[model samples]
Target: MPSQTKRKKPYSHFRLRKFLFFTVPFTILALFLLRTSSSSSSTASVSSSYTTYQPPWFGDLQTAQFPWNRLAFSLTNPPPKTLKLAVFSRKWPTGPNPGGMERHAFTLYTALARRGHRVHVFTSSLDPFLKTDKIINLKIHPHGDAESGKWRYNKAWELYQEENQKQPFDVIHSESVALPYWKAREVPNLAVTWHGIALESLHSSIYQDLIRKPGEPRLQSFNASLYSAVLPKILDEIRFFNNYAHHIAISDSCGEMLRDVYQIPEKRVHVIFNGVDENGFTSDKKLRSLFRSKLGIQENSSAIVLGAAGRLVKDKGHPLLFEAFEKLIETHSNVHLVVAGSGPWEQRYKKLGDQVTVLGSLNPNELKGFYNGIDIFVNPTLRPQGLDLTLMEAMLSGKPVMASRYPSIKRSVVVNDEFGFMFAPNVEALTTVMEVAVAEGAERLAERGRKCKEYAAEMFTASKMALAYEKLFLCIKDERFCIYP
Candidate 1:
């Protein structure tokens, strides 16, 4: 009886051990599945909420009693008291083919000067024939050799100092890192607008890697130096950012990153979205017809013209666009693609024949005409950094966008899903969105464009952006002017 009791005890212990081995794993698997399901539900809810979400600033703009709204009106009506502004831009727009940053500097300072401010731009040398200082209150002080197209920051700084000695600048603005950290540290009233930051570049590197094809060359090599190099560079940048007095983020996501990830003080960081020339890019039906006719797309035909502009490089997601559009044209014969801008992919797009129109790099006026011609604007960017000025330009031109679902674009430009369609950074996702746009047809797209134009008019005009910056400059000059009202 004693031997049997001992045997029973050993048998019971063995059974207990077996139960735990199987039960523990089963329990873990159940919990993981539950968590995944919950996460998916949460994502769906967030997406549904986006359909009704209007940006808080848009609400303020709509309210007549809002102080910011009142301020916008006041700035344009009689204009604010004249300010002496110093702008440090590495390169100023010399002609119609300036890059985005140069275009931004030109648009902003020009708008500020038009409002009666005395503005001086310290930049690299321009072409001899290029006419500048055409605006009454604006002047350009070029500092480097025009032949090399090399911008000398030291020379520009010397020019700025010489001018500052004559008349102190009310506010100094630096486009990106044009003003070096050493020089920036000494300027108390300086604000630097960050078009792109190192941390964003790190994320972009990772994003690009995730979507890379099986046989594609990894230019970013994200996994190889993620901890070894990228992280250390980001840390160095976070430390270097402290040298500047104030930071201006061009997108909402960038602003959050400045305060949270970069650990910059909340008061020192400001978010002012990039704006477009509203008058130049507008919804003109006659112009639209004329441009489309030139493209050989008949108005009466069922054809839907989709346009994409900017440098046709890999980072612009042209590879994904090329693949998606190729697949799209196979199934849908009525859809046509018009590409502006040029790069390595120009020849590839031209290979698509009559269905694709490769316009190459266009001048500002021609770019405007291209915008009016398209029923939908597609921006398939893989690098998620600064807000593309093209997005704003397209919206202002009264065209709905089909852009990547990056946080910068989703939060800032397409806050409401009604404005445009967004897809993940992959060929399958892009192709799906393109198909949806085709199904919606041109007339339905026009309705979306109208809504997009209305929202863009209130939010993305040069006047609004200039007014916001003017207010910030005023506040920086005098703390008493910092009051919201």
Candidate 2:
């Protein structure tokens, strides 16, 4: 019996070893194959998404002209239906001077209000000089302390909540990040307009570096901190943006980034360009002559006045403009530069003497005069984020533009070369364009300005932008209103 047991144990051990040898190898092979399949499937899925995904509205935005005449008819001869809009803006335009986004909010909401819609604005404290008595159908709910001029989003959100409960808003609009994602996720009829996104800021940073001299310090260090800091933050923003119900990109490039890079669904993403008050900025011969006379440039003089307006910061490309204009003035005595707005570079522009006119900060009326006064508007901004309203304003004001060759400007504003000249963000490129403007003479530039005014009137007017937003708001309230022409 003992001998038989020993023999059986050895036989059992041998069988177990045989099974382990075959089964282990087979299991390992199966795992390797499964992993390879999964990796390939993931890669294919990503590639398929990029190749196959196409939004219904995807097209050349410049050519896809909105039916302004039809939109006008719809707005003027509409049924008795008006939207109750809730707007979240960090800072409302109180005084004559406001930032671009604030100006945009003011223009859009005021236009909507004039169209008989009720706009309830929840924003920071108003300026002491502002008078809101004339604004009709638009109620202001100011939160936060007025002394410090600090905006409190939480307080503004609280006010929004209270008003919402009293009479639920038909649609909610957030100007940039005034309303955070956590709150936005709960609202179905909400759309956040991204004037600029973080990825665009990354692009701006890259361009900033490119514009820098070869040996100059890079804006961002090329080190482990980039991997550990900048990229992580951008990735987090990309993830967080998905929580919003809808996105309204202010530029065509921005719209594509939201849909493709941020992975926002096509149905939830829309593109709407910024608009300016056309009436305030018009082609007036008398005004242009008067403004030029004020600037000491004779009406019959051959001197060409080139204008720039915005915060005089490095990111605004003042350094490049300063250098380029310096080189330009060294040869072309007929070219003059006019700079509006105030910042650190204000004194630097002042040092350019009579060749450059620093207007300090101008009010709305002064800005109108500034646009009319110049022969050609020049915007040498390095940051490639938001579409500068100055470009639209310049065109609408009946003047040609010489702006940077950024994608936003190239794709949206400067779609046709006849509108203006575009150059790379460098001293040599800008100087060359400026020389061309000088050579074209003021009369030829004015001819280009005429074409610019006609196009700007079609695309960049406040009425068109308002009607577009009104239609979008109506569609959000009722899907049946989402019909396209």
Candidate 3:
């Protein structure tokens, strides 16, 4: 046979040697992985268990019992033993805003300062016209640079807290979003005055955009991005802010929204409509013609001159205004639309190829001139309305108005067909209403406008708004001071 060699029997020692060669590294690796996993699990557990408590900015004022809960008052009473006030804002009106909220802030600051109240405005420099006794301009990175810019805003908020620690204010009055939430507990008394509230899906979207980007295309994002991205975040923030403070609603609708959105206690919310300087928005013939002439508008043109002023964004119904004007033009040969204010969609709306006059923007004094130049003023803002200062000005100007029948506008500003026409938000309904308004003519419309002016003169005047706020502030302050006194 082929000389087969006897195979040696395998020994346990030889098998052990082979096993060690293979198993040693694997064992080491398993142990290393197990150790690593254990460390990771321990870290995660610690992280999960740790929680930080952030005290509310406002104390439990509304929930306080008896006389303490009731707002104290001082009508023809002595000045407080100790007076301290805190004002919060996000942006002051400095550079390029259409001068709505900034003007209100400047006016509020000046008025409060003149009254000898120690008013401090904590805000961002994004506002162009804001200068006051005390201002905290939070540093923020330039727009679109989120990574670095975020830190700036974070630092600014931290600075606000750090600075407030030096001297605690007796009362905190905030105009911007969520300051009352952060500062409520730190301060004794807090009152937040809202400029607007988010009621609808669209309103919520817009507010989130304002929170994210103060200006530009982000503000103009519509149905696609609004529903897809903004809606959820806005809902979250609204819920957060609503629960954060003793919320003040600027309009009746806002109060209702607060009640509906957060189930906020009825006692915690109050409606305080914004007011305008009635004297500044007067109707003068010479001023009217001066502005009309500047716009190449003939005073004698039989056309129904309709004016829509404010930022020409999609929501403001600038496109709808154009569509309505195009239809109204077919019926009324003398119809002209003058648009004042500017935004991202200005050129796009301008390209609609209508006979509408885009006046871009006007100064405060000049805005009155523009209002006077027109026969009827329309506030075609789309969703979730409050009182736009322009609507107040239009009412003050004795020019008949046409506004969207949104809850806030209808409740706060729009009285009736007597004051202004309340129409549907769509183009067809708005266009049909415009036709009726054009047919109403200047004499009848001016009469309605006069009534509106009277209403505004008595109710919506700045003096009236200021006096109410003063009373409310003094009442809160007196209560807080009395506790210590």
Candidate 4:
């Protein structure tokens, strides 16, 4: 019995040793492998997401592959007299994201369509632009980004050119300087208008100073290589600008910018100021009061609502305006500011929160209501923007304008104490202008509003812009004057 007990004890000790030495290590090893495998799987999923989407155009979809020298299409069918017009842009007008160029393109297209012309707009995606069940009228094509699975406009242009080899339209309208086109040689009477060049845009005093901060990698070291390399290539294409069928400028200054920078002949550069839908901006006092009430303004208070809209960037002069507004509040009572739009410096303007109403972004109709409610419209632009559609809308809203006298604005907006006031694009100058305008009282403002409406009706209407573009397209079709004037 003693011998049997000793044997059992040795066997039990062996089993205990095995559990301590092997089982614990094995369990830890299994957990480590599981964790590693999970991490690897997640990484693989992320990598695969970026490369999967192929829109109609980008890669293997070459529409037209003719050499640069050979541009004209072989006439398989007779071309129409009025010409089938097509305009291609990188993006379209959609609220706060919509810049002047996009609105100009849309208004031009809508006007053309109204005049019995079939206009097709090729865009990447309408995600943020506008939503609708019926997109049949616009012919929008969706192309996804290479990694994000989203469509890109440049890629769509490549595909459209490849698919439509016959040069279906007499002329092609291109908004960006960087789109693919068919028939490099004949060039199909393509009309290209630049919103404005970056070379000129970044040369502004504020932007130049911001990029030159100490301890910062020079702007030259960062994105400078790209602009340095690509812009010259883009500008070299400008000889074709004046030579194209019609070159429309948003303002006389924009036309001059092209002429001076590109040496584009004056004959080819026709000034066609951008226009707004005046009918859409018509306002009534009842509508104005309703909008003001919703915005929390008391009806009896002598509340003066001053509003401005644009990207919240320094170039738009929000900082300067804020400074001026703070100063104005010292002497004025019951003054309120309504700011609409978003940008990088959204938080910087918070100090004026109580005195100012920050309505981030509003739709076209909402903007019309806001404009009508405001006592005056202020455009404080630190950069050169094309004919600002917002300013035009404000003018059409029957409000007086206090705008920056940038060269572009000076050429486009007429300034009179009776109609509106223009100030140099600086804090002191703008402050003085606003102070005077605000103190001028209601009768003077009403007279100014009347002139503002008349100015818009005379110059910045959609019909006038459309007619100018049509005439320009006709000139291009006829090959009127090949060289710059």
Q: What's the number of clashes in each of the models?
A: 0, 0, 13, 21
Better of 2 and 3 by TM-score: 2
Model 3 over residues 169-203: C-alpha lDDT tens digits?
Answer: 65677774536355454444677776765445465
Model 1's C-alpha root-mean-square deviation from the true structure amounts to 7.0
Q: Which run of 10 residues does model 3 get worst, by summed lDDT?
A: 45-54
* Predicted candidate 1 versus true structure: per-residue lDDT over 1-485, tens digit per residue: 45654346658988999999999999987985566455434332332233444233333211111113113445436444678999999888877678889988988989888888899999888888877658888999989655534689899888998999999999999999999898999999999999998888886776677777789877655556887788898898899899899888887667767876799887888777778888889888788889989988887978999999999998898988999999999989999999999899999998887899999988878888899999999999888899898998999999999999876777667867789899998999999999999999999999999888987887688888888788778877777656655
TM-score of each: 0.85, 0.84, 0.70, 0.71
Q: List the residue pairs that clash in candidate 1.
A: none
Ranking by lDDT: 1, 2, 4, 3
Order of models, best TM-score first: 1, 2, 4, 3
lDDT of 4 by residue, 1-485 (tens): 45654346757889999888998889986975565355434322221212223222221101211110111221232223455666767766544456677777777887666565666666656664456344323444444564322336566666666545745766677775534433322464677766775444644543334433358665554366446754664465555454454455565556556655566665555556677887888656887888789878877756677788877787777877888888888888777778888876667677766777777778777787888888788888776756678788888888888887655665455533455888876677878987787777655776788778876765666765666566556556664422211
Evaluated at residue 180, the lDDT of candidate 1 is: 87
| Candidate with maximal lDDT | 1
Lowest lDDT block of 10, candidate 1: 61-70
Candidate 2, position 449, lDDT: 93
lDDT of 2 by residue, 168-271 (tens): 99999999989988888888889999988877777677677777677887645654545676678779878988888878877666766676678888778877
The 10 consecutive residues of candidate 4 with the worst lDDT sum are 60-69
On a 0 to 1 TM-score scale, where does candidate 3 land against the true structure? 0.70
What are the lDDT figures for the candidates, one per model? 0.81, 0.81, 0.62, 0.63
Query: RMSD in angstroms, candidate 4?
Result: 22.1
